[model samples]
Target: MAAKLEGGAYLSSFVDAVLEKLSPILEDDDFVLEENDSALELLGRLERSLYDVGSVLDDAELKQFSDKKVKKWLVDLQDALYKADDLLDELSTKAATATQRDPDQLQHKSLRELYVEACDSLKLLPLGDFPNLKKLMISKCQSMECVVVPQALPSLQYLSISECPSLVSLPALTLTVPQLEELHICDCPEINCFAEEFLPPSLKTLEVTKCQKLASWITSKGLQSEGLTHLWLGPCFDVKSFPREGCLPASLQALKLSNFPNLETLDCKGLHHLTSLKSLAITDCEKLENITEEHLLPSIEHIYIGEDCPLRWKLARRDGRPMV
Candidate 1:
């Protein structure tokens, strides 16, 4: 007997239902359990964690809209759970087919089959099927080049892509995702440009790392959002300076820049326009010798610069000096 609660269905019970349906098949003599012991152990751990997660989801559902942070946390949690479920399904299918056979022949067959399956899974990402998708993350897909967004995604709030070295660009993906709120791109070196209109007005946070050729955000009328609250750019060596034209978002509240060896200076005029900025961090820019704060706003409260930075004295505010 199951309790009839008046809210979202519990995920733990869903997993239990799956296990109940699959129990008889797993007990069959054709399904050798010993051959799939490792996968089953992992599946057990995932199931237990998901059971704990269901409580968190239930709690969040009751108070999500009242708190912005809670809503964001729920989105992230749901995205992670969705990915875990996909991987669990794949592992379950693999386990169901595991069987004992001659040692030498079984070893060779398993290796070839696993390699083919891994390759196929890495190349296919069917995001277009979800009409109300929010928060998508595609990681470790080495052979992926293009991610196609076929339809409008008004509900999408976050997107993250990482470790896809062969990916050249996001083609026609951002056009349909106008409501995206956060984006993170990491370890994708071959990417060159984030074209105009790539970032929408609804975006609040953007983080990029180790993208070698991505010179600057304002290169060609791109990344000119006024609603951005946080921006992080790191390990992008080719970008020698912040855009000289003062194109950064005026509504930005936090900014972080790191590991740009070629970066020489940041245009003070642009930095001055960030009236809402509360935190600014710059690190590991070896060649950054000339930084000006002539027009910097007084709203900035926290400032962090590397030891090599020449503008450290300008950031200090303990001696009754104004942060002008």
Candidate 2:
């Protein structure tokens, strides 16, 4: 496929502009924003993720690189950013319109139907008995100390939590939100470990970041989910080693690990059990010392390692091709 001609800097600029407009509204105290509104909370997370992408693109300058993978990633990011920009525009209009509405009518506005943001704590009943709710997102609520899943959200298919520094634990997924298909938790520094029954068989995608305590847990007991296809764990400094094969599910197709600064060794013999694995990525693991063909699975088609990785040059392909 031909690469797009647009520059990455342009996309970075667009994201910066979007953040500029959205940040003020998020901080506006005059809007009488409800602390527990789920929809607005989801939007706040979307904004925060966009902001994070903007920061990454600004520093990456992907337009200068001729690599096909980098170009493709940039193109995909541009497409997503355009959609996010439009959504933010609509949200801004709603916030403005809601501000103009009379108090009585506003109380009954449908905008109140979404998830909440910036709550001091996630009590058990944020969305009490939300039987029909399909998605719930919580983000940037720094004071949120715990998450207690509501019992009636059997229909929930997606759940995400980000930037809640004080959040320490999450309820077991098997006990709550059994239908959840995607789960993402990011930048929650205080979370130490997931509940033992954390991986509900219905989940397909899982992503976790910047949770040192959780990273440590993974080292001793890797996640196993027969239904999961994608897994990402990164930026957790406490993870000193990788999990053995018995701890991982055979259904995982793509696995990515990043910035585990203390990681020193990986048991490749243990990784051979992931028969369905297609892609493996190890980036910014500075202490990782060696990676040989024995440590890789024949099923892996794409392997990406950062230049800073100690064993980048040692990683090879089963088919005699370069392993990047």
- Candidate 1, 190-305: lDDT as tens digits: 77777555468888998888776663533334367768999888776666666455477888999888887788877776787787888988888877766554545578787777
Best by lDDT: 2
**Residue 315 displacement (Å), model 1:** 4.9
- Per-candidate TM vs. native? 0.59, 0.62
By TM-score, how accurate is candidate 1?
Answer: 0.59
Which candidate leads in TM-score? Answer: 2
Residue pairs of candidate 2 with colliding backbone atoms: 36-116, 37-115, 37-116, 38-114, 38-115, 38-116, 39-114, 39-115
**What is the per-residue lDDT of model 2 for residues 51-147, given as tens digits with 9 covering 90 to 100?**
6776677445645375667667776777876676655554543453343444454432333234545544333223344455677777876676776
C-alpha positional error of residue 293 in candidate 2 after TM-score superposition, expressed in Å: 5.9
CA RMSD for every model? 17.9, 15.6
Candidate 1 yields a Cα-based lDDT of: 0.62
